[model samples]
Target: MPKISNQNLFDALLDSWDRNNTILVNLLQAFSHGGLEIRAMEGGPSIAELFTHMHYCRLIFVLEDAPECARPINRQEWASEQDPSVLARLLNESAAAVREAVKSRVEAGQDMLVHYDHPILMLQHMIWHEGYHHGQIKLALKLAGRPFSDDEAGLITWDVWMNKT
Candidate 1:
């Protein structure tokens, strides 16, 4: 594909990630440390675990998909959501790494390290994966009676994530 094409694909993927971040930030802002620990169910991960795993998932994408991208070992020694600031910071950092890895893979074109891969597919998987968990976050907040606005809920809609074109 052409450079512009790669850029456009990257733009769309990043936009999706941005919406995911916006929604998660709004959800987290509604909670305290204790609230983040509330699991929506006994079998499911808590809100904090969800966020932690989400960050790790992004890191895994880069590790599995883009050999050229460099990132440190992001240890999950503690539940990140216990500290709001730490959770927010780690999420942003991991998300940015995801963007960089995807961008690098796209720019490298055929030289990208996979024999049967495209960054778009990886990005799509990331977005869809987060989206599946986003609903859990929303439910966890609702179950806790954590306050949020319709605006925040709506921000994750396709219009916001897809309109940057």
Candidate 2:
């Protein structure tokens, strides 16, 4: 059996992680403040709430497994913030924390066994979870009469995750 080097794997993982984070940032920046209030269903979470929830999930994971790398935030406070800029700032901060936590763990050769047994699984969990919520947020935006063209949506969600061409 060939002994494979994991350096490439780690680098690719980090790239995938960063790509997923950019999806959120791009989606948020694509819309206006009023669009944050849009909801897909009458009682479903608004775009702001969905974003807040995604950040909250990341924050909680980091706080529990990598407190030193976590940037603490009041979930209620962030959810109440209607300003898109503020929300974007908060999202970036949390994303950085998660990135740091993952990077540090990889550098230190550590495993986040408290929950997901390993760093890669945890990272995949975050990426998958955020992707699900991003879909909902986009759906909400579409329901609110603001939406990306199919090409734009393809670019934002699909092409962005692909390797640089």
Candidate 3:
């Protein structure tokens, strides 16, 4: 097996973060046009609820807390419609928070340690979770007969950032 250098691993993680951010921004933009209905599955959370949940989860990771298991699981029966602009703002804030956390870890010389319950893991899991929800959002868009694009998905290739040496 080929050995991976610390710098390479950190770079890969950073790239993943960037790609995840791009996907999230695209999803938020898609939701902004006001055609898709964000609803939870089988009494689950609505799209807005999921977005808020993602934001809060990012905050928890930034504060270096353990990752919470499972989402709220129940929809707010009479939740108000979330503003697309607010969602966008939250996305930007969360991205910035993750980036800052990464920077701090690097500066503190703690990025090389393999932590089982590390904040980096939380951030990575949030990105993966976001991607999963984004897929669900795309499916909903298709079922609603709404137009969507894969421009952001194209921005997710690992090679783009990996070759930045």
Candidate 4:
């Protein structure tokens, strides 16, 4: 495979994070009003809680690893029923904070030890965690009889990765 320059590699990583954030916000926005109350299973976290938890997880890492990026992210009580749009905004903000924290660490050649992992691992963790939650969100919608069409789901999750609108 052809090798990419360091800057290109970093940009790719940052773009991936941005796409992740976009997918997440789009998924949440796709929900109808009150769809946030949907849950994947009985007694499981609602869609709102899932979104909130994702943002909370990001904050935990940023607060510990990059306090400067933590200011814009307000701390919310876990699993609270805040508005979905509000959660989306917070998620975007937190994602930007994560991007900054990771970028600074990589550029300065500094090691960030969060949960015994480096910045790259931390970003991987966040992406994996959010993707898992995205599945849960979709499942919740389906369980509530409001599932997205195949095209919609594909666009939100897969096409976003390809940088397609």
Pairs of colliding residues, candidate 4: none
Q: What digit string (tens of lDDT, one per residue) describes model 3 on residues 3-112? A: 67776787677767876776676566666657434553456566666666767666655554322221222233333347777777767777777676765666565542
Q: Give candidate 1's error at residue 63 in angstroms.
A: 1.4
Models ranked on lDDT: 2, 4, 1, 3
lDDT of each: 0.69, 0.79, 0.60, 0.79
Q: Quote model 1's TM-score.
A: 0.75
Q: What tens-digit string does per-residue lDDT give for candidate 4 at 67-141?
A: 766655446636666587787778888898889888888778777755635677678888899888888777777
Query: Over the stretch 46-125, how does candidate 1's per-residue lDDT look in tens digits?
Result: 88898888878777667766756747746673344577667888878877777787777767674335532666666677
Q: List the residue pairs that clash in candidate 3.
A: none
* Model 4: residues with Cα > 4 Å off, grouped in runs: 1-3, 72-77, 163-165
Ranking by TM-score: 4, 2, 1, 3
Top-lDDT candidate index: 2
Better of 2 and 3 by lDDT: 2
Q: Any runs in candidate 1 off by more than 4 Å, and if so which?
A: 1-10, 32-34, 75-80, 111-116, 147-152, 155-165
In model 2, pairs of residues that clash are none
